[model samples]
Structures are given as structure tokens and as C-alpha cells.
Target: MTMKKKKTIFTAVVLAVLLAACVAVDLTLPSYHIAVTVIKKATVYALVAVSMNLLNGFTGLFSLGQAGFMLLGAYAYGVLTIPVAKRASVYQYFDGGAIQFSLPEIFAGFLGDTVGSTVGMLLALLVGGLLAALMAYLIGLPVLRLKSDYLAIATLGFAEILRAFFQWNALGPITNGSNLLKSYPTFAHATPYVILAGLMIAVILLLITSTYGRAFRAIRDDEVAAEAMGINLARHKRMAFIISSFFAGIGGGMMAMYMGTIAAAPFKSTLTYEILLIVVIGGIGSITGSVLASFLYIFSSEWLLRGLDSGKFLGINSPIFKNGFRMVVLSVIIMCIVLFFRKGIMGDKELPDLLDRRSRKRKKEAAGK
Candidate 1:
């Protein structure tokens, strides 16, 4: 067999093994285990970061409206999947609630309880993504006309406006008006998350390798030239925006399931900033880098540097170790990376690309010898 084919089989086997191990851990270990929680959060963030990269990295659109799309998705999923019996209790403050139905229950009637609920949850997540894409299409019509910082500012303002709108008292009946949305269906294990994220990312990779992907990269490199080359710049840009928002929405749905609650408060501009930072740290144009950085970011922030929040580490207590110290250290590390490794950890390259390069280098050395 060819070396490339062998390598492909090896990579597939390794991934399968890792996935099996993860499922085993999820089944055997407690749900509250820190590692388990981190993996879940990382998986969600990885999806969102990759979605953001699809627009910002490939299409060269500097959008900051991810939080808005995410909020829409979270609320959509939460509102639809919440048990019908719990609606009155959840929306007690909003005149006994506006929505009196449960999507999963509707599906349960036809598909049986367990399977129906799962199918309904999947459908609800899809609805969330569709809603987000619709919003993106509406917003992108005018916003895409702007360039660079102007586009970013407009999108950021839109997110803030949407947040405020969701919190408005007039929208209370539907949105719960600043109150938390809970009692929604959620995944009990990590296997589904792994599968869903893997599938979505695989779709994204396929998109990136297609003809449209080349057009996106072309526009990213030189918009005017791409336009001159007969590419419909506006159409391609809008497509990218809508597609990115769709995935962002799905990621948000996953996050809502992971958290078991949804609130407009958490879906702020800061959330967008965090996702953008992840993309930058991961290598803006590299999906593998985003996935890798997601785990690293989650681990370091949520686990490794957790001790910095307290005054103890490695059995040593120090005055310097205090609240906010972790963020300070993380900020410094980000700054160092920006200054020294501007292209980020992967630098617009995938793991396979790196492996191929190394293999070629070794072959060249062998020939020289």
C-alpha cells in the first residue's frame, strides 16, 4: 500500500480508539468529574471557534455577531425542548408563559418517548440553526456592505441590541425577560457530542476543499481581484455569513445542553471575543488548530491554572496567587504568542499537512545522504 493510504488508515484507527476511550470514560466516570466537564465544554467551543473561523479566516469577514446567533439558538432550543409540564413553573413571572407546548412531546406521540425525545431534540437544534441563519441573512444584507472595523462594529452593536431586546419586558412572555431558561433536554453522555461535532467539522472541511472554498480563499486574499475574476463577492460573502451563523447556532444549542440552562447574560460581546481569541490562537485558517486550541484553552483556564484563583498551588501558599491572577497570566501568554508566533500554533496548516511536510523533509535528507 502507498504510504499516504497507510497513514490515512493509521489516523482513522487512532481516532476510533480515542473515541472509544472517551465513551468508556464517560460511562465509567462520574459526570461531575472535572475532566469530563472540560471535554464537553471544549467540544462545544471547538465547534463555535471553527464556525467563526469559517467566516473570519476563510471569507475574511470580521464579524462580531456570533454571540447574537448563539443566543438565538440557545433560546430557541431551550424554549422548544423544555418539558410541557414545567412551562408554567419556568415562566411563572410572565403571565403563566407564552409557549404552552413541548416539541419533544409532540414527537413523542408518534415515535415513542425515548426515541422521539432524541429526534425532537435533534430537530429543535436544527430549527435553532435555521433561525440563526435567517437572522444572519437579514443582518448580513446591509452589514456586509461595510468593510473591516466598520463591519465588526456593526455586528457587535447588533449582538448587544439583540441581547437587550431579549431582556426587554415586552418580550418577557416569549423570552422569559432576563430570567434563566432551564428544564430543557440535554445529552447525558459525551459520545453524542463527539459524534455531532466530528460530523459538523467534517462537513466544514469538505466545504473548505470544494470550489466555493477556493472562491472564499480568493476573496480573503484580494476581494477586488476575486470580483474581477467573475466571483460574485456579495453572494459568496453572504453565503459564508449565513453558513457560519448556522453552525454557530448549533454550537450554541450544544452549549445550552451542556449547561442545562440558557440566559442572555452569558451571550455577550465577551463571548464573541473569547471565540475570536481561540481562532487566533489556533491559527485562523486551520480547523485542526482550532480543535487543538479549544482543548488547551479549556484545560489551562478551567483546570491547570485554576489554582491561581486561590492562594495555593503544589502545596505552597503565596500572596501573589489570588483571584484574577489566572487571567493575568493567560493574557500575558496570549500577548507573547501574538508577538512571537503571529500565525498561531498551526499557522493556517492542518495536522496532515504538517506530517506530509515532515515526511518530505526526511525523504530529501535520505536522498542527500
Candidate 2:
């Protein structure tokens, strides 16, 4: 087979195996298992991290407003998906909320409970993405004009402002006024989360290979040169910002589904920092890197090392292994990884690229013989 054919087959096989494994685990384990939670959380992070990487790595836009967009999305999904009957309890502080009709209910009436609710959930996510994109457009008009650290600062400030605005009592009827948004429908299985995140990431991969992705890369490399070559610098930057925010918004919806509850307090600047850290560790410009790094990071922090937090880890039980110990160990490991691979684990290369390199090396060795 040709190298391209081989790569395609390999990727397909890997995906199939992963799907089967996930399904098996989901069927065999309890819903509250750490593995299930890790998978769900990792997929959510993978989508958001890739979205951030699109602007920061692929397009060289250093905006730090991911959490704000996510907050917008989470609220959008929560506000739109709460069942009509449950609104009274979920929104007791706000007189059953400003919007009473749930998207799921509207669709379920005609499409049946199963498929209709699924469709409704997807629609709500799309709405959240659109809302975030709109906000990005308005915010980008002024903030995008800033450069480097100024741009980062402006975006971070925007996130903080957005978080506070959501908590404001004046908007309680819509946002629940600092209360948790819960009782919304959520996926009981990890498969759906994996499928959704995979589809979204695949779309991003396709975008990266298209002409627009090239334009993004050019701008990242040198704005003056790209602009001189007929690329619309301002327009592309705005597009990148808007598109990234759109995906971030959708990712936020996924996050809400995973958490089963969401509050504005969790969508803080620290959340953005964590996503950014994932992008950096995954290799900013590589989609596969982001995805792999996300899973690895989540597994380490959420599952593999969780025992340290309870004062016991691996066969060793020490006083030092008490609350927050896992984070300390995780931090040291992250530092080691960073020091070892200055450019990140994948360093801008995809899985196929790595395979090709290995193949070429083997050929060279045979040729020398």
C-alpha cells in the first residue's frame, strides 16, 4: 500500500479500537468511575484547548478571554436546556427565569424524547457558540487592535468583567444571579462526549489544512509580509478570534454537560490558564498534540494521581501526601516535561508525521547496508 493509504488505515484502526474500548468500559464500569469522568473531562478540555490553539498557536493571536466565552456558552446551554417543569426549582431566585421554554422540550414534543432531546442539546450548543462568536466580534472590534501583552490584558479583563456581569443580581432572571444551574439533561455515557469532541476537533483539523489555515499561519509568521501579499490582516485576525470563541463556547457547553452543573465562579481566569497550559504542553500548533496532551493531563490530575490527595499514593503513605499533594507532584512532572521538551511533546508534528519519520529512518538504515 502507498504511504498515504497506510496512514489512513492506521488512523481508522486506532479510532475503532479506542471507540470499542470506551464502549466496553462504559458498559462494565459504574457511571461515577474515575475513568469515565477523566474521559469526559479530557474530551471537553481537548476541544477548548484546540480552539485556543487555533488563535494563539495557528494564528498567533494571544488573547486570554477563553473563560469568558466558555462562561457565556455554559450559561447559554444551561438557560436554554432546563426543562420547563423544573424551571421553578432551578430558577426559584428569579421567578422561574426569563426564558421558560427549554429547547429540548420544544424539540421533544415533535421528535420524541430520545432523538429530539439529542437534537435539542446540539442546537443549544450551537446557540451558545453563536452567542460567544457575537460577543467575540464586539469585543474584538476594540481589543483586537491591541498587540501582544496589551491584547492579552484586554481579553483577560473582558473575561473578569463577563464573569462579574453573569453574577450580577440585575441579570438574575436570565443567569440565575450567582446560583448554580442544574437539573438540565446530561449524557450518561462517555461515548457521546467523545464523539462530539472528536467531530469538532476534526472540523478544526480540516480548517487548519484549508487556505484560511494557511492565511492564519502566514499572519502568525509575519503580519507585514502577509498583509503585503494581499492577506487582510484585520479581517483574518477578527475571523480567528470569532471562530476560536465560537468553539470555546461549544466546548463550554460540553463542559457543563460533563459537570452536570455549572456556576460562573468556575469559569475564572484560572480556567483559561489551565487550557493554555494544555495547548503549550501539547505543542501549540498541533491539533493531535493538543488532544493527546489533554487526555494525558486529565488522567494524571484527575485519576492516576488522585490518591495523593487522600494521604496515600502507590504503596507509600506519608504525612506529606495529604491534601493538595497530587497537584504538587503534577506540577513537578509538568516542569520536567517542559524542561525536557522545550517546544512541547509533539512539537508541531502530527501522528502521521511521526510515523513517516520512523519509516524514513528505517529505509535509510537499510539503504546504508
Candidate 3:
């Protein structure tokens, strides 16, 4: 068969498979809601993982500011979309509260009045992305110049500083310092997590397939080599870092909105480490690995570890283990994955390459026969 015909057939087959999978996934099961919630949580970690992969996996950068970006995005979206009256209720010190967008303020047409909450949520997500992107651009400037461990420390410190800044009395008008915020909007249906998961998956696919993504990989493989070949290292590195931060921020924003409260303490070093563990366990540079790892980590924490320690069986109740048990098991799992599989599950390989190799091998065997 001609190459064009073969290509067309392959494209059709893939499209059919994807459509079938979507349909299958859409059909509800007994744990439909639970699965959706898990998927959403997985998506947040996956987005941050992909962003980190673009830097550390593909670009050879080792930064750890995902938590910071997430916080920034979360707060930005939280503050922006809030209704002015509700702001004071949600965060007491503000007094001024939040500004509400009129139908015309949010939309452009006659149907704006009837645009619905879904449309408004989408807009809020977009705003989150933009704000995160802007924050990333600003942060990327000074930090991107550093290399390796220094960069990682710098980024980690940046996150902590941001957390501290939020807690400062000067910023109390918005964040309300140590006080908890309430009465904010929530993504009640499938959970903010489901929306976040879907978005991160779409974004990971977009970045890895795009020309910009290729550039990111090239820079990761060898910065000097990439620069010598006219790759514009600084510009591309900055771009990749900013994009990662932007999505991370969006994830954070979604998390904040869903939780209906934001506190500086919970989002500090511990949050950063948990996400880092998710990324490392998932494989540093592999989007698929990150995604799989997130699910594994979250689910295992919720179910497997609990089962193991609690000794819960077919009909017997066992004493539950302390909360720290899950973290200990998770850490061991991460270490094992790192030690046994250094390159991660996907490593530097794209899924398509494996398929291509399989097809070529089959073709060769057939020709010999």
C-alpha cells in the first residue's frame, strides 16, 4: 500500500479508538463520582508534573516552585472573580469585598444573561491561566538564569516567600492573613478536580506535540547545543518555565476555589514536597508517568495503604493506621521506582515511537515470510 493510504488508515483507526474510549469512559459505573474526583486530583498533579517535565525532564532544569505558582494562580482567580459583597464575608478584613461582573461584563452578546454558571467557570479558569502565565513570566526572569540545584532552591524559596507574603499583614485586605476565607464559589458538579484533570490532560497533549514543546525538549537535552543551533536558549527556557508556572498556577487556583478556603500554612513546604513526590514517583520528565503516579499516589494513600495497615479484610475490622503511614509507604514506593527504573516508565520516549517501532518490526517479519 502507498504511504498516504497507510497513513490515512492509521489516522482513522486512532480516531475510532479514541472516540470509543471516550464513550466507554462516559458510561457510568458504580464508582463514577469517586473516579471522577480522583481523576481531577490526578490532573492537578499531572499538570504540575508535565510543567516540571518540560523543564527538568526535557530541558535539564531542576526547579521546585510548582507549589508557589499554584498558590499565585489560586489567589489571583479567587480574588478576581469574587463578588464584592461576598469578599468581606469570605475574608473578613477586606471590608471592600469583591466586584461582581454584570452579564455584559462577562459576556459579549444577548445571551450573556443566560450564559450559565458553566460559562462563568470557564471564564474564571481562563483568567486563572492568564494570571498564572503573567506571574510565571515575572518570576522566570531572575530565577531562570541559575542552573541546577541553585535554581531548585531559588524556586522553592520563591514559593515560601510568596506564602509569607500572603500571610503578611499588609496583604490582609485580600488574603486576610492567618484567618480562613469562606463563601467563595465552588465547582460542585464533578468537583474542581475533574475539571482540573481534563484540562491538564489536554494541556500536556498540546505542549508535548507542539513546536514549542519540541524546542523545550531540545533545550533540555543540551542547552549549549540547542543555543549553538540557534534555538535561542534563554528565550525558550523562559518560555517553558513560564508555561509550566502558568498551568501550575491554574491548578492551584482550581484547588483553592474547590476547597472554598485558602490558608498560607497548609500550602507551604509540605504541599511542595507532596507534589514533588508525585512528580518524582511519576517519573521526572514523563507526562504519562506523572499522570499514572498521581493516580497511584492518591489512590494508594486513600485505599491500598489504608487496607494494608488497618488489616481490613473480607469481614473483619482492623485498627486503622495513623495518617503518616501512607506517606511512609509512598516514600518507599517512590524510592523503589527511582532505584529500579531510573529513566521512569516513559522516560525520554514518546508513546508514538513505541508504536512506530512495533509496526516496523511487524512489517520486517512479514516481508521475510
Candidate 4:
């Protein structure tokens, strides 16, 4: 078979195995299993990390406002999806909030509950993405001009400000005023989460391979050179920011669903930093690296390391291994990964690229022999 056909087969096999695994996970494992939690969280993080990578890695925009955009997405989804019947209890302080209708309810009236809820939830997620994109466009107007650390700081500050704004009592009618947004409908299994996140990540892959993606890379390489080459710097930069924020927002909506509750308290700078760390660990400019690294990071931190915190780690129950100690070990492991793989696990090249390169290398060796 030709190289392209072989690559196609390989990709299909990998995807089929993954789909089977996800289905098996939900069908076989308990809903509360660590594996389920890890799958949900990892997929969410994978999408957010890739969104951040689109800006920081592909576009060379140093922005630190991911958590803020995510907050908007989370709130947007939560505020819109809370059941009409449960609104009174959920919004106890805000007179059931401004919106009276839920998307799922409207759609469910026509379709069956299962399909309607899924469709409505998807529309809400889309709304979240659009809202984040709008915010990004507004913010990018002023801060996108700032270079490097200044841009990062500006974006970070804005994110903090947005988070605070969401918590303001005056907006409580809609935002719930520092309270948790709960009772929002969510997928009961990890399969949907995996599929949704995977689809979005696939879109990112397509974008990265598109002409605009090439423009993003050009700008990342050198703005002056790219501009000289006739790439519209301002337009492309704004597009990149908006597009990145759109996906981040979707990720945030997914995050809200995964957690079953969300408050402004958790969408902090630290959250952005964690996603950034994942991106770095995966490789700055590698999508496959980001996705793979996200799963690894979430799995190890949330599952494999849980025993360390609960005094049951490694068959060595000790007083030293207490609450939060797992984080310490995880941190050390991350440091080691960073130190050893400075270019990250995949670097800029993708898995397919690596596979092709290896194939050619082996063929050359065979020819020499």
C-alpha cells in the first residue's frame, strides 16, 4: 500500500480503538469511577489547551485570559440551561433570574427528551463560544497591540476583572452573585464528553492545516517578515484571538457540564496557568502533544496520584503522604518531564509526521544495508 493509504489505515485504527474504549468505559465502569472523572476532565482540558495553543503556539499571541473567557462560557451555558422549574431554587437570590425559558425545554417540547436535551445543550455551547469570541474581539482591540509579557499581563488582568464582574451582586439576577450555578443538565456518561471534545479538537487540526493557519504560523515566526510577505497582520491576529476564545468558551461550557457546578471562584489565573502548563508539557506547537499530554496530566493528577493523598500510595502508607502531597509529587514529575523533554513530548511535529519520518528513515537504512 502507498504511504497515504497506510497512514489512513493507521489513523482509522487508532480512532476506532479510542471509540471502543470510550464506549467500554461508560458501559462498564461506575459513573463515579476515577477513570470516568479523568476522561471527562482530560477531554475538557485537552480542548482548552488546544485553544490556548492556537493563540500562544500557532499565532504567537501571548495572552493569559483563558480562564476569563472560560468563565463567560461557563456562566453563559449555566445561566441559559437551568431548568425553568428549578430556577426559583437555583436563583434564590435573583428572583429566578432574567431568562424564563431553558433551551432544552424549548427543543424538548418538539423532539424527545434525549435528542432535544443534547441539541439544546449544543446550541447553548455554541452561544457560549460566540459570547467568548465577541469578548475576545473587544479585548484584542487594545491588548493585541501589546507584545510579549505586556500582552499576557493585560489579558490576565482582564480575565480577573471579568471574573470579578461575574460575581457582582448587581448582576446576580443572571450571574447568581458569587453563588454556584448548579442543576444544569449534563451528560451522564463520559462518552459524549469524549466525542464532543474530540470533534472540536479535530476542527482545530483542520484549521491548523488551512491557509489561515499558515498565516498564523508566519506571524508567529516573525510579524515583520510576515507583513512584508503581504499577510494582513491586524486582521489575522484578531481572527486568531477570536477563534481561540471561541473554542476556549466551548471548553468552559464543557467544563461546567463536567463539574455539575461552577462559581467564579475557580476560574482564576491559576486555571489558565494549568492549561498553559499542559500545553508546554505537550510541546508548544503540537496539537497531538497537547491532547495526549492533557490525558496524561489529568490521569496522573486526578487518579494515579489520589492514593498519595489518601494515605494508601505505593503500598507505603506514611504520615508524610498526606493531603496535597500528591500535588507536590506531581509537580516534581512535571518538572522532570519539562527538564528532560525541553521541546515537549512531541515538539512542533505531529504524530503522523513522526510516523512518516520514521518510515522513511527505516527505508533508507534498508537501502544502505
Candidate 4 lands at a TM-score of 0.97
* Per-residue lDDT of candidate 4, residues 188-287 (tens digit): 8999999999899999989999999999999999999999999999999999999999999999999999999989998999999999989999999999
Model 2 is weakest, by summed lDDT over 10 consecutive residues, at 333-342
Per-candidate TM-score against the hidden true structure:
0.97, 0.98, 0.81, 0.97
Number of clashes recorded per candidate: 0, 0, 7, 0
* Order by TM-score, highest first: 2, 4, 1, 3
TM-score, model 2 to reference: 0.98
Collision count of model 1: 0
Better of 1 and 4 by TM-score: 4
What would you estimate as the lDDT of candidate 3? 0.68
Stretches of candidate 1 off by over 4 Å are none
lDDT by residue for model 2 over 200-227, one digit each (tens)?
Answer: 9889989999999999999999999999
CA lDDT scores, all candidates in order = 0.91, 0.93, 0.68, 0.93
By summed lDDT, the worst window of 10 consecutive residues in model 1 runs over 6-15
Error of 1 at 54 (Å): 0.3
Per-residue CA lDDT of model 3 for 1-369, tens digit only, reads 865576657755764674454345445543245554555456566666666666677667788887787877777666666655566566667565434442222553444543544455556666777776787788888988999999989989988888888788778776676677555565644434554555676676687779887887778778788788889888988888877777777778777765677676667767777777676776666676777677788777765566555555345565555446566766787788778877666665544445666788999999999
Instruction: Give a tens-digit lDDT track for model 1, residues 121-185.
Output: 99889998999999999999999999999999999999999899999988888889989999888
Ranked by lDDT, the better of candidates 1 and 3 is 1
